[model samples]
Target: MELHEYVRLDGVGLAELIRTRQVTPPEVESVAREALKIADERLNGLTRPSFPNALDAAGDGPFAGVPFLLKDVPIAAGVPFTLGSRAIPDIAAAHDTELMTRFRRAGLVALGITTMCELGLSFATESARYGPTRNPYDPARGVGGSSGGAAALVAAGAVPLAHANDGAGSIRVPASCCGLVGLKPGRGRIPCGPDTGEAAFGLLYEFAVTRSVRDAAHLLDAVHGPAAGDKYLVAPPLRPYAEELDAPHPRLRIALTTDAWSGVPVDPEVAAATARTGRLLERLGHTVEVATPALDWEDVLAGIRGEVVAGVAPLLSAPRQPPPEALEAVSRAAMSEVRAFTALDLLRTFDAHNRVSRAVGTFFADYDLLVTPTLGQLPAPHGTLDYDNPRYSVDSWLRRLFAYGPFTAVFNISGQPAVSLPLGRSASGLPIGVQVVAGSGREDQLIRIAAALEPDFATAADRQGTLDQ
Candidate 1:
């Protein structure tokens, strides 16, 4: 098959083709490598291209022969695992993390590793080490980080779907930018062990960015079990995620609010898209209302700041830290400031986090879902929030980042499952995603709603040629 032919297939399509013997796994892989070469020339998304050795050990499993890419943060043995940081030497991981092991067992043929923000500390993909991972929709715009490169590659058809994880909107942010389905699973829904414990004390979840909701659901089915000694494990889904795609989603009381949790004015384009989606949901028999959890912004910010700052200290102990010249200046400066935060600060953050979680849970008691703009604004120009800029302090930088992506982190803070679906477009032709957030351990519900909303967004994006096959 031609590379273009392979690029158009979702993960399931490729698997089906391989299963029927229409294409050998090696043939599909060859086409995928060709697609990667072309996509990299245009998007500059990869930090490591390990194609020569990537498919060597992928054995017969359910998704046999499907190509995949990993964001650099996850540990993948024999693949360069630089976290878009110049502070670490360019070295391959000694072993795969438990999640990586599951990905391989799913029969995913590894393509390469994608770039990320330094230690994933920033909202933009202007990595000093790997340069920039640009938006696939418009190369001049930014692809949201720190899963930015993985999103870019998938969005541009380098691979059908690629591995991604979210801490503070990393997956959803980029998925919003590139017109893909990005589902941020609830914390501990997927295992994160045998290397590091849960990121940010269970604030992060591993998943993928895909062209369709069913693809996202299928991928989750392949990788959503607890590893043996996991510190925190979420309850298992009643059935595989794919099974939920066809199940009739009951009429839901969905709360729709265009307001940003952080006091930023949501972009008019984003607001209109969300309102439009609310109308669509109403027409589809779901009850849509205008309401949001009354969240304390200050507490939310404090807890987020605390978790992020505290998480970095442990990563530094591993591997040698490079000389000052090797690190981004902003990163080097923030390292000292974060280190100085007292343990009491972390305790306070935990307290604040618990408060927000309880509030969100209370709100969800009355409403089954919360619908909002995934991003507060449209995609920014490529150089908008450069982390290497010496002028912006950490305080000012975070404020700007929060303003840009205000809605996504609230769910992250509350540990709710949320999916960003591309349902609208800016007049100038940019993708705007509507975020659907459900109560904790309700990804099955979210996926059903996502499967319904998916077509509307795909249709909207296609009108602008962004989702054209």
Candidate 2:
């Protein structure tokens, strides 16, 4: 298999080639290793090329023989789990997380882990520990994080699909910037267990970024199930999610909003791209209206803040915690600020979360889906969201992060399924994503809509060619 040939195929396409014996797993894997090395040099995404120690699929499955990469945030047995921070020493996981188990079961070849923001504290991938992950589309710009590394490599055609998780838009924002399909499956649709019950009190979701809607659907089909001790679980889909691609859905009532919840003015190009997606939805027989869910943006940020503080406080307070100098300025500030939080502060945070979730649920009772700009602006230049800057306190930093990605965290709070599709491009050729959100446990609907809308954009190979030029 040639590099061009390997980059052109999506995960399902590669699986077909393997299943039909057009190429052996070794042939495809060798090509994938070559692609990984080239992509790492060009994009600075993979934290370490674990090519020599890469794991092969155990049995034939949908993604059998397809090369894959894991984001460094999750635990994969024997792989380094850095969580993209210098505060914690990089150490290998003793065992696999449930999601990693499923990935293996689905026959995805584990290539290596990729880069992220330190503690995933910011929306940009510039961490003090491993430097920055550059966008393949334009190296001068940012690849949104903390899944930026995964998005960058996948965008540049290094791999068909890679592990990505979302906590306040980690997955979707990178997918938006990198021109990939980023699906943050509804809370509980995927498990995060064998270590923790729920990540960030269900504000976080585990999934992947893919080149096509079907790949996302197929990946979801392979991994969407509860582990034995999960804290949350939703009802299973009526049929396999892949089947939803061809299933005709009734005309959907969609709410489209370019307005940012954070009061940040959306970039004109991004807003126009969102509007164009709404028009495309209307043409596809869905009712598109300019409406938004009633949300208290402050309340959403507060809940996020509480979650961050609560999760990090224990780690920072531990006797063996890293030295104060090991962390970024923002992280050190968060460590200091969280010490002041009392039980009442946490109570208020939960109250805010309850209010925001209920309000969005009520809005969804009327509308089947909501469409918005996945980000408030185009990918920022490096250092735009610098974590090392001492000016930021925890609250101020969260505010800045949400302001750039004003539209995504609301769904994280609501625990709903949302997807960012690379539906439009700027005059300078940067990718702009249009986000489509569905009610809780309605990933099937999201899949159908994404498949319908996917044809409007250039193919991944075409975008990569443009980047190459």
Candidate 3:
């Protein structure tokens, strides 16, 4: 297989070719590696030392031998899990996390671990540890983080779909910036671990970003299910997610809003594109109305901060603590501030989470979906969310991340499923994502709608012209 031919095909497409014996797995892997080298050189999307013997590591399943990459955050046996920070050593995981086992069983071959933001904290992928993961569409621009490196490689056609997880829009934001399909399955729709019950207090979701919606659907089908000793589990999808692509949905009541919950005004281009997607939905027979869920922004932000602190504080306070210079400014600041947090602060944060979830859930009772701009602005220039800058305090840094992606984290807070589709583009031809969110355990709705919307966006081949530059 040729690199061009390989880059043009999505995960499902490649699997079909291999299944039909038109190409062998080894041939596909070789071409994919060539493309990956180019992507890393051009975009700096990968972390050190590509996975050794990755083809040997593949399992026999639906996507057997299809090229894939894991984000550095996920645990894969003998693969470096850096958490995208120097603060954490590049220690290879002792064993596979449940999701990693699922990826292997699905037969997706991981070529390497991709870059991410420090502690998965920011909205951009410019880490002091690994530098920035540049947007393929515009190398000068940022790839939204901490799934930014995964998005970059997928967008560059190095891999069709790669592992991505979302905590506060990490998956969707990058998908928006890089022009790909990002599905953050509702909390509990996908399992987090045998290692930990719920990650980031249930704010994080395990999934992937892909060039096509069907790839997203098929990947979800292969990996989603409950594991033993899990803290939360939603009822399984009625059918495989792939089946939902051609499934018909009733005319949905979709609420459209470009309003940012954090009080930041959305960029004009992003707002117009979101409104246009709402109009498209209206034309497709859905009722599109100007509506937004009533939310207490203060509580929502605070609850999110509590979750971040809860997840990161332990690492900061570990027996072998990372030296001061090993950590980013925001992380170091968090270390300092976490000591002052009262037990009541965490309790109040949980209380706020309950209030916010209930409020958003009520709004969903009247609507089948919500649509919004995936980000408040375009793909930012590198350093826009600089982690090394010492000026940031923990509170202000959290505020900055939410301000950039105000529409996304609320769904994370609400534990609802949401997807970002590359449905529109800016005047300059950069992709603009329009997010579609469904109520809890409603990934079926997201799949159907996203599949319906997929045809309107440019394909991977069309977007891969960035490689020529």
The TM-scores, one per candidate, come to 0.95, 0.97, 0.98
TM-score of predicted structure 1: 0.95
Summarize candidate 2's per-residue lDDT along 162-222 as a digit string, tens digits: 9998888999999999999999999899998877877877788899999999999999999
Candidate 3 lDDT over residue span 1-469, tens digit each: 8776888888999999999999998899888888888899989889975666783455469999899998887478777677888878877788888988888889998888899998888889988888988888888999998899999999998899999989889999999999999999998878899878888888888899999999989988998989998899889988888999998879999999998877898999999999989888998899999999999999888888887777677775678887877888988888778878888988998998998999999999999999999999999998887777789887888888877888888888889999999988888878899999998899999999998887788875568445533
The per-residue C-alpha lDDT of model 1 at residue 358 equals 92
lDDT of 3: 0.87
- The per-model lDDT (C-alpha) reads 0.82, 0.88, 0.87
Candidate 3 structure, TM-score to reference: 0.98
Provide C-alpha RMSD values for all models, in order. 2.0, 1.4, 1.3
Worst 10 residues of 1 by lDDT: 459-468
Better of 1 and 3 by TM-score: 3
Give the number of the best model, judged by lDDT: 2
After superposing candidate 2 on the true structure, give the runs of residues whose Cα lies further than 4 Å from its correct spot: 317-319, 464-469
